[model samples]
Target: MTTSSSPLTHFDGQGQAHMVDVAAKAATHRIAVAQGRIVMMPVTLALILAGNAKKGDVLGVARIAAIMAAKKTSDLIPLCHPLALTRVAIEFVASPEDSAGVASLIDGETGHVSCTATVETVGPTGVEMEALTAVNIALLTIYDMCKAVDRGMTITEVKLLEKHGGKSGSFVNP
Candidate 1:
């Protein structure tokens, strides 16, 4: 785990929010990985897996949304600096069993669809926000596509799993 004693960089001396300046910071290879999961009814998950969603290609469209979200992170986040991302990768995993290999029965027969997004850029600022945003958008896209069938679906545990580069060095969630 990485801990920083430094104060929040987005606030000025007067306590006003502002974007941090990265003009003098050296550009380095930056990578960030984020993950999240959406839980839905087992039947809903089966529908998605069988490519029977009314909106069509739930995972495929979510993948594209994740990539687009990574590229547009700065636009969505006020203090984020626009980055020239080198790569954006998205992965989806649908599992009926939990990590322990036992059926994850929650709220009466549920299934989990996990999204992992890896965003990379060569820039002064880290791409952590971009990666996190990608994961969120991807999960939201899935929810949007399946809401009609599974309105009770929940999106949870969205977070940055790890990040590398910039003056902060590296960080991994413990």
Candidate 2:
């Protein structure tokens, strides 16, 4: 469980779960970036690299899934507000070079592909949930598409790398 200095935003002062009213808040440009990795056997990696997965293009399908998931974040997560996204991007790389939206990719013996989701919106609410949802869905889709080839695949390090806009302003994971 996590605790906050202030009341949890999803709950009212009375401790009841509720959708936050952003009617009084000013609309601002909001953006969020998230990343996660799916680890699998080297053989499975080779299959994906060779486009031999039985379920068609794994990364291609996952990229679309991530974008769609970001747009439908409100429907999937209770208390989240739906926003008209300005931009959404999903990228995957075995070894990433640090850039504005992507985090420093993990370098390890485990064969993993890093999936990064970047979401932007002009609204009263932030798009952190949308970015995170996109990453989660992307990772899950990768697992689903590759399950037959490697049931041992694991989704790990799902995280909200950064967020910008709203009253809280910008935040980046250190």
Candidate 3:
């Protein structure tokens, strides 16, 4: 929350989660990167690669969905503060996509299509939730588009990869 001692920012002394008061805090350049992936059959991956999925452009649509979702993070989650994000970049990767890790092509049966959202804003609060929401929405979009062909698609590795700015300064996940 406030980078104070309290472990949770969304709650009060009574522990009921509330929107933390960010009005008093100084606005800073804050950024958060969130990432996740959808694991599917090799055929599903081929369809995405070939742009032959019945759902139209899979990664293209998912990218837009993620950015839109990040911007609407506050509305989607009750406790989140609606933030004016400066940038929301959704990068899609096909695996064995090692680098940024949006998608992967590890084994024969599983193919990963990962989405990473980088959210930036000059605000008092962090964009971690927004980033996370973006990643989730992106992965969900992928699942929805391909469900007819691959109902077994699993969303995994959804997390805030890192955050910068604000009182916390910086955090890199290990």
Candidate 4:
């Protein structure tokens, strides 16, 4: 597990929740990337890949939802600073087989769809939350779009892949 030497910044000595002040910090270019995956029935994945989902264009709509979610992160999370985002990129990939390299079997057949979101901004604080938010919204969009057919779809491994800029410096998941 990863450990931090510094104390949590979102709380004061009294343990009251509060937003961290970044006004005194200098503006710098910041970027963060987050990713997640959804596992669903192979047939459901086929429907999505074949563009036959009842909702229409699942990935395309999810991409747009991710960008919008990144921009609106501050509104969704109270402690987050509202910074002017410079860029947001969302990508989705569909895999016919699971990571275990198992081939599609009758009832056990499964498909994986992954979403990655990269968010960039020039500001005092980092955009980690924005990137994470984007990934979550994207996955949720996928779930919403295909839930009628695959109610058992599971979203997993939602996490920050890396981050750059800010006083704390850079971090990459190992």
Candidate 5:
């Protein structure tokens, strides 16, 4: 059954559940950051900005949640190798688009709430998935916690912003 990289070691071509062997792979530092956005009404956005979203500390809780989720990526996503994350950071920022002296979003809406998650590790594999997962989980948490205030919230543009320190090298979004 030995073929190419070998049948026992190479599982991608076999279509079976098998953990990748990293014994021969060199260990290197890895880091990745992902970002996303949640759009909602201006009033709803104001409630969050004022720290009165009824859910209490929306960004604070979401940040913590993202960090915790990143640390437990393996448990949440099947097939993901359990990793000891060296560091995980999640951030939230309000992005309001204004055109000169004109109001943005027609009715002066809050535009969007940006959520970013950065993950780092010192291991053989990469942390891109973990970082992206953290951003997703955090955005979902924000939606869940603020649904009562704004049911129309939409999450968009969830992507890896950048990654560095790996055998395959670094990646930056254009």
Candidate 6:
């Protein structure tokens, strides 16, 4: 297990959270992927699928929100270094079951919606936080647009799936 004093290179001497000093680190291409899920009622899912959510196109707005969030990561997250994002992608996949929010795009059943955000950058620091923020904002946008139909919607499974670049090399969830 990684310890607090493992010479991780990002720690402050006092052990309090501190931004990593990347002054000497070489600039490199970096990418990070994050995923999350939102669950809601079948009718709510139908409304979303049919583009009848009343709040306009849910996916279109959510995608824009995610991209904006990725670019404004430092503004939203304190202490996060502002880095130029090379690219960002956020997409939603509806579940395929009647009891779920959306079973399939072709079927009328309601199942869950899965969201994934990938962030890429060529910088000293990684884009993990940007990717995560994009996923979160997308999920939040989904909630905001659909709350009128399903107040009990649940957002879950927000997690980092993979990371590439930086001194640590690469990482992927086992």
Query: TM-scores for all candidates?
Result: 0.90, 0.88, 0.89, 0.90, 0.85, 0.87
Prediction 6 TM-score vs. true: 0.87
Q: Across residues 1-174, which tens digit of lDDT does each residue of candidate 4 receive? A: 334344888877667778998899989999999999999998888788778999999999999999999999999999999989999999988886446533343677688899999999998999999999999999999999999999999999999999999888999998
| Model 3 misplaced regions, further than 4 Å | 1-6, 97-107
Q: Is candidate 1 or candidate 3 better by lDDT?
A: 1
For model 5, what is the C-alpha lDDT against the true structure?
0.81
Tell me how far the alpha carbon of residue 23 in candidate 3 is from the true structure, in angstroms, after superposition: 1.3
* CA displacement after TM-score superposition, residue 88 of candidate 6 (Å): 0.5
lDDT of each: 0.90, 0.86, 0.87, 0.90, 0.81, 0.87
User: How big is the positional error of residue 22 in model 4, measured in Å on the Cα after superposition?
Assistant: 0.2
Candidate 6 structure quality by residue, lDDT tens digits, 63-159 = 9999999999999988899999989998888766455544344544446788999999999999999999999999999999999889989999999
Backbone clashes for every candidate come to: 0, 0, 6, 0, 0, 10
Q: In terms of lDDT, which candidate is stronger, 1 or 2?
A: 1
lDDT of 3 by residue, 48-119 (tens): 877888989998999899989998988999999988889999998787544653334545658887888899
Q: Write down the TM-score for model 3.
A: 0.89
Off by over 4 Å in 5: 1-11, 97-110
Q: Compose the digit string of candidate 5's lDDT tens values, residues 5-79.
A: 545543655455577777677779899999999988877776766678787988888888898889888898776
Q: In model 2, how many backbone clashes occur? A: 0
lDDT of 1 by residue, 1-174 (tens): 344444999876666778998999999999999999998898788787878899999999999999999999999999999999999999998888557544455667689899999999998999999999999999999999999998999999999999999888999998
Give the per-residue lDDT of model 2 (tens digit) for 39-137. Answer: 887767766766788999988999999999999999999889989999999999863324542334344444788999999999899999999999999
Better of 2 and 3 by TM-score: 3
Regarding lDDT, does 3 or 4 come out ahead?
4
- Candidate rank order under TM-score: 1, 4, 3, 2, 6, 5
Task: Tell how far residue 49 is off in model 6, in angstroms.
Answer: 0.7
